[model samples]
Target: MAAQGQAAAGSASESGGSPAASAAAAAAAAFPATSLYVGDLHESVQDAQLFDVFSQVGGVVSVRVCRDINSRKSLGYAYVNYNNTSDAARALELLNFTPINGKPIRIMYSNRDPSSRKSGAGNIFIKNLDKSIDNKALYDTFCAFGNILSCKIATDPSGESRGYGFVQFEMDESAQSAIDKLNGMLINDKKVYVGPFVRKQDRENVSNNIKFSNVYVKNLSDTVTDDELKEMFGKYGTITSAVVMRDSDGNSRCFGFVNFENADAAAQAVQELNGKIFNDKELYVGRAQKKSEREMELKEKFEKNIQEVAEKFQNTNLYLKNLDDNIDDEKLREIFAEYGNITSCKVMRDSYGVSRGSGFVSFKSAEDANRALTEMNGKMVGSKPLYVALAQRKDDRKAKLQVNIFLHGSWIYTTCAFMLFHNSECLVFACMVGEKSGEFY
Candidate 1:
């Protein structure tokens, strides 16, 4: 695997010896020489189906549908191995975008070294594209330049094109030629912008230099009027407009906006007035952002806080099921008290105050939680054995359940299909035997 090669190489470099370097070199040499990575496969496509489709062009030595180990559900990608490099190349040429299970599969040579991809050596970004363009159309448009490693169009959740895309070529010359010829060309009646791809962090750093003319201010004294707000900020900037936000009842909301005549003036006002006391309250000032931008910022902050909390309690929380009907919060606490310091324990109940036969327990330390889990799991309490494990977030539990259901359904469908085929074969054999023996009525 790529990870193994990287680890081995790192070890070799750290040890400064030929043995480790030779081992790393051997590992890199032995990996996936004739293997093709097949991506964008449908979840239901398995190894057998891939082999049947790919074997027409070459001798397939192996096919593997990558899957999640826990649920055994397809991960939407696979690997196909051929006996020789020529066969592998043929398969890649003939079946790059072959449709299976109503979805197209993308094929590429399996590259164990990830540096070429990560370095963004020959990647280009295309924007302002027509919404009609997709992956295949983009590929067709650019393939004349050189060998493309990958091409993709950004799309929304509903699968609508987002008017932008990325393409990475195998060689920098190809990428440069494409950009030079097509950077401002009209495609589908839209003039597109094509350039070398810039990473998100770099783009963000560049955006920090952009100018703005509108400023937001909060923590104003309730009695401050629009004129007073203007007077307070007029010292640093030429105010084009100033307004104190008011409620339906016409009372000040203690926040307002100021639009300066120039971006530099607004920036200066913000720099000087922010965090300064204005009418006994510390003023907060910043560039005014659109509602969507504010919402996105808040959402990111909320998710970060949630992740921190989850990490803080990661190994110290336990979920319990098959609880006895007689168990209550106090009894749950009593059961886990011997393991370690019990922070919180609760047995869930319905509105009618009846036991739900499930509970949660929190410990002050991971060791205590692990000890409790080892001792209590599958242990008989009253009429059933308890199920205990580390608690998962609601979203994670839901996703696991969905994967399990999908796998179970696929298994049932496959079993039924095999049964039907077997029955038809048996009927044909019985009819032939009867005809040959002259026993048919």
Candidate 2:
């Protein structure tokens, strides 16, 4: 909401000299036919005050200040019915800023049915209100800026204020003026938040658009509670809710969700807390992804992993045995560089920091590797002959291992029954096909 200055001419009737005449002049420009909406009255200023004030202009018919059904307290606004249309018009002109019990009230033409009014025409939403501040208190607090049409404080089933309300002014300028002066102002030691009133559906759509503000956290300590989680993430911004998941036994499931007031706070919490240790275990925090999204991402990663492994076997990679214990990755690359553009080279190392006496060298092309294998096979390196051959894939290595196991009688079986009895585990079932038929390759 924004503020606007009231025109000086509008307040000329408040100066007192022949107020009724000045009101009649102002009414010519903006006047109602019969009823006037009076707002900003103190909780004690009842229908009597409204009737007494408007009666000064002309004949008065009825005055009703809306109130709670159970408590029967003033809702801070009322409707005044005047006998003559011109009398109602003059009431708005002169009584626009008339004081009632030390508070200046706003008066405007009555548009009683909200359904007939334009949506959000001059409305503002107010929240963080003190629980004790009823409709009258809210109205009296905001009435001085401009004429108000209707003011309402949301209440619960028990007729208690829900700490929020709505204020609608006759003119947008007046609504803006009130917001500018009263928004964030302290009332009853609590600062209230004021903003433009949006329709519920529009608010829901906006919330959906920024739903990333809610974060999912896992690996929480068993002792962690909702309040603790809120305190941890509240530094970033206001938190809407925080909950730690639990089991049937009331034990922590090691997971939780934290919803912030805005996306920026959620993003910050994710960046700073993801993978950070919490209660002796690393916690995972991130935007809560749907189950379908997680499954799709895992599938893509699996496909990518298979592609990478396949790429290793397709390149000009060569396996070498009898690699010197002292040969490191850089030395192996240097030795193979003369054999036509080596793409990569690495000597396998054991846990004790010694080479496994084997290494792999990948060249830019298969032709280069074939030539290098021909030239380097049986060549002396560190007093031992180098054994050069095409590198075998992980699956191919498994196939060879199965052949060696079958030859050594480790997988001996006379019939399919015996194989099934032993529950034989084969890494490459296809490679064993030829072995069972007396053919070994």
- Who wins the TM-score comparison? 1
| TM-score (all chains, Cα) for each model | 0.48, 0.33
Report the number of clashing residue pairs per model: 0, 0
Worst 10 residues of 2 by lDDT: 415-424
> How high a TM-score does candidate 2 get?
0.33
Instruction: Give the local distance difference test score of model 1.
Output: 0.70
- On a 0 to 100 scale, what is the lDDT of residue 234 in model 1? 94
| Predicted structure with the largest lDDT when compared to the true one | 1
lDDT digits (tens) for residues 130-225 of candidate 1: 887877677657655556667788864324677999988777887897787778777777788989999887889887767999998888899999
- Model 1 earns a TM-score of 0.48
Once fitted onto the true fold, the runs of candidate 2 whose alpha carbons sit more than 4 angstroms away are 1-31, 36-81, 89-108, 112-118, 211-441
User: Which residues of candidate 1, in runs, are more than 4 Å off?
Assistant: 1-33, 112-119, 128-132, 156-163, 188-191, 211-215, 222-282, 288-441
lDDT (10s digit) by residue, model 2, range 1-441: 222232332342364544334433444345445877787666577788778878988999999999979857677788898897777766765676667876667666677576746588789999998888866566556555455566778864224577899987666886786666667777677778887888888888885565478788877888999999999889989899999877679888767888988988898888898889877988878787654444444444444444344344443667889987888889888877887987778787779878899988878765577668877989988778999976643433421321122223311221111110001122221212222111112
lDDT of each: 0.70, 0.67
